[model samples]
Target: MGHDLDVLAARFGRHYPRWLLALLIISTMTMVLSSTSINVALPAIMQDFAIGRPLAQWLVTGVLAAMTSGLLLSSWAQARFGPRATLLTSFGLFLVTSLVAPFVTSIWALIAIRIVQGLCAGIAQPLSMVLIFRTYPGEGRGMALGLFGLGAMMAPALGPTLAGFLVDHFGWRAVFWLPAPVCILSLVGGALLLPTLRSLTPPRLDVPGFILLNLALFGILAALAEAQRFGWLHDATLLTGAVGLLGLAAFLWRCTHHSAPLLPLRLWRNASFRHTSWVSMVLGVSLFGVTYLVPLYVQTVEGYSASDAGLLLLPTGLVLGVAVFAGGWLSDKLAARWLLVGGLGLLTLSTAGQALMGTGASFWAICAWASLGRLGIGGIMPGVSTAAVQDLPAEELAPATGTISFMRQLGGALGINLLTFFIEWRHVAEGASAAGDAQAFVQSFWLLTALFALALWPAWLLRSKR
Candidate 1:
């Protein structure tokens, strides 16, 4: 099978790298689409399952937690099984799980399937990065990554609108089945075109490190998830958060001492790696937090239907998709630092605009500001990611990519929790009036704006030149 794939890739390699990139982008977009599209469906799911906001949120958090855990295993999987085999296996699992998800009657069952789907997505995500880096030449690597980011970025951008339509017209189950055709195409492409690239020295799996990382991530997420319900200073929240912090400290210590840590401590030795990781975390916060909050706000506070809420982001997503490609192309020729700074600035402005948005604000005005923020995100993503590992050796690239991706997912999970906590806290304090809900959302947006501003300091630390 490996030999056959190699020959086939060579045959296709004759046409141009674009075809291979198309396959990868489609595969990756399916996973990303799966991730973001569900946000719009959460309310519908809540209605169907007769659950409250907190339980409904697990649909998002569970997938993120599962994806984060799956990311830790990706480098090892690629090293042990080789890229083509890993891609084929993961893609197949994703397709099967997504197909099965819509049929599950129980909410717990659906969440379980979502986690499995997230695991498959988590494996594919980092591998896609490695594949792009390997397939494209060094000079053109940014352009390749940019194209890949375009697909990944666009999925979230457009996914909600599509999901809203499906959920509104066909029911929430339709959202689960939306990615099937794309996944099928991606599966076929992976079998034929994905290269059989394997690490010569596969790293040992650090089972203890994996466990500690999950304990930390899951604990922190759970703490944040329940903080609003239990009170921020409640013993339960404090204990869970403390345990998570200790687990994180232990995980870091283990990485420093272990011969083959799950996440190599040495990756941080590079200045670029350190800065880019911080930027990626902030990017994740903005990206995922906004995606989660916008639809909920529009539907609940502003009285828009799910479809209308989803459509509000359509222009922003389209702008982001285009900007990502341009950002990638320019990163190859310009200083990444400028791009980072500029992108963060736009993100800050856009987020702040959202924070200041009045209940009576025009829909187009909201779209315009959000599109500006998405544009900024588009500029920062490709440049920051490319810069993160651009200086590392080939052997270190896989783990570096995995680490970066992990941080982003971690940030996303935490960001959603943080925003939710703030929203709930404010809503309770301000009283449950419709105006109060709007106020809570506005306050949460302010918090996000502050995060984007804080990210700029690290973005400035990024190396100016490639």
Candidate 2:
């Protein structure tokens, strides 16, 4: 097999790595598109299903929660089954879920399918990142991830616009149908491009740790979702929140005691990885929070059609694609902390700008502000991703990637839930009129701005001496 691969490598030469990276970018982008595109369609789905905002949000939260738990599985999966088999299995599952999702009548059924899809995506994301990091030379990894980030970030940036159009013309179900073709293409590409890399002695999956982690995530997410309806101090909310916090404490303890832990907590021993992980979580909150907030804001508050809401972010996506590539390239030459600080600064400005947006704001004005924030993200993604695992030893890379990805997804799941409840709480407080709607969204954007600003402290600490 080694000899055959050597011959194949010689035949393909330098192009082989590029082809593999391309396949990874495409497949991962499709996974992201399947999830992010749903944001614009949520209102439509809510109407069709006769659900409220809390339940409607499960469509998005379900994916993030399952995906967060799934991140821990990738290290074990890739080691046990090899990258080719693991990725193919993930792609296959995603393809099946994508095809079946549109036909479901119940929102719960659709949410269930989304959870499966998110799990498949969860398994694929870190694997792809590890493969990309391994494929490039040390000097070139920043550029390689930048290129990857271009596709990954672009999916969320553009996905909403396309989904909006589909929702307006065909219906919300059309959003699910969109990713199927891409999934099929990705399956074919993965079979041809991904290499078979497996550990001889793969770590065992920590069943107790996995269960505890999910319970923690589910309890927290459920508490947030329920908070808007039952009040934050209510017994149901308090109970769920307590369960989540306790589960988290137990999961952390298990990571240290378990022989084969799901996510090795020891990765945090590296100071750089710790700082970078903090920034990654903050980045996730910004990434998913804005995607969720803006679409709903424009449609519900400003009375923009779904298509118009989607269109608002199209320019932002394009900017992110270009900026991500540039940021990646720069990361290889410059200090990552410099880039992170600068990026966070830009994000702070962008979010602060967004807080001032209202119903009277022009379409182009909204796009400009959103695009500014994405440009900042392009800068952050490469620097943080590269810095997180660049210092870790070879054996620890897979778990490190899984851990960082887990943090990001965890932040996103909880961020969306919290933001959902915050908006609901504030909207009612403001009297629930057009004025109230605008104020609620403005306040939400301000909260995001503050989060971004708070992250700057950690971003500055990312390899400061370097």
Candidate 3:
């Protein structure tokens, strides 16, 4: 009866394909916008805080720690609460968070709000994928995922540039305000257009699992992020990291054996799931690094201002949007394996090209590499997403989607941090000095290239869609 209600809602109301696509894009944009805006404003944040400088900025580190924690809860929330409620709640919190973020008076306060934003982000993203599976049927389903990717993936690509402009001309506060309406609009629009699909056999919230999982993540990531700055075995960070790892191991043990694990282990049984998870993990480390490094390349190395770097990256978002659409259409027609392999291959090449870049590399060369990488990323993301969750039964779709998406997010976070740490280590080893210098950035780019290459082996295991 409820399924019939959902059908009627989807059919008689605002119909799910194009309208829901718009909603999905808008919804994801709000989160993407928030994330990008924060990155652009980190400098202003330091100035406002009048705090000490660390090699890795606390603004980003704090957000990552928070987002990682949030990922632990997202799947459980979607399974227990229903995707529609989860999505609505996430966007609603996001809007509120974005509106008030600019007014934060202290660095810790800012970090706190961002941590909350990450939690909200966790709910919004995984739920977006789950909805497409539920609302979009047949080929339209593939199209829906593509459109969702366009908004989610492409937004961050363009956001840094836009945020740079807002921060330079306006204050950092403007960054928070710009996305306020977008979030609000997404909330209102989603409420109206998206069908009310409630959870089936809603599971009770697993509070103990949530606590254990988060403790593990917090300890592990904090240790990893801080260890590069602090020593591994000498510092408290090492202790924190060890605790987190132990917690993670325990969490896994529970997941594999528990009747109602936070994330059911059976989902990993799909070949696509296993492949995409590993590949996405590796790509996460590389792609996240590249996104951060790319802007730094143009601004610090090329001597362009933040605004210029952002504008240079603008074309990337356009290309990426186009790629997502094209990739999604092709995902349905072609087996994802070759597409996956080809996309990752191109991405690896682009990373290598970026790594080889010297201080004097031409502007056009940089732009060309960015475009190529975007194209490859466009092709592979849909394939990763579509293939990863393909074999799951209807009931498990949300968790499957959430778990894969979570891993990707997790990968990207770890990748960016790992790259940053590796580059910093290289710089210190070579006695390189300061931010905004091309010499300091060169080795880091190469390291990331190696990381991208490392990501390719997972795609080898992917079988052609038969």
Which candidate achieves the best lDDT against the true structure?
2
- Candidate 2 backbone collisions, by pair: none
Worst 10 residues of 2 by lDDT: 1-10
Tens digits of per-residue lDDT for model 1, 1-466: 4444456657766554677788888888888778878888887888889976666676787788888888988878988888888988988888888889888889989988887888888888888878777667577776787678777888876888999899889988999888888888887877667778777788788999989998888788777766766767999889988988889999999999998887788999998899889998888877777888888888878877778888987888889888877787777787778888899999899879988876768789888988898889877887677778877888987678778888888888778877777887788789977788899988888888888888888878876766
Please report, in order, the local distance difference test score of every candidate based on alpha carbons.
0.82, 0.85, 0.70
In candidate 3, which residue pairs clash? 161-310, 284-412, 285-415
C-alpha lDDT (0 to 100) for residue 436 of candidate 3: 34
RMSD to native for every prediction? 2.8, 2.7, 3.5
Question: How should the candidates be ordered by TM-score, best one leading?
Answer: 2, 1, 3
On residues 1-466, what C-alpha lDDT tens digit does candidate 3 reach at each position?
3333366465556554567777777867767656655565655565677753243344554555556656666656766766667777887777787788778787677667777787787666766666677666576775576567667777777778788898778887887777778777887876666555556776676676777787786676667666766777756787888888888888888788777777667877887788888877765554455666777556555666667666767887788889878887788788777777878888878877876777777767887887888888877877787678766678977577667666776776666666566666666766666543455577776666676666677776777763
Comparison by TM-score, 2 against 3, better one: 2
Assess candidate 1 and give its lDDT: 0.82
- Candidate 2 residue-wise lDDT, 1-466, digit = tens: 5423344467569787788788898889889877789999999999999987888889898898998988888878988988888999999989888888888899889989999998998889888888886677586776677677678888887889899999999999989988889889988887777777778898778888999998899888888887887888999999999999999999989989988787788999998899889888888887887888889988888788889999998888889888887887788788889888988898999989988765678888888998899889888987887788867899987677767878888888888888888888888999987799789889999998888899988877766544
The window of 10 residues in a row where model 1 has the poorest summed lDDT is: 1-10
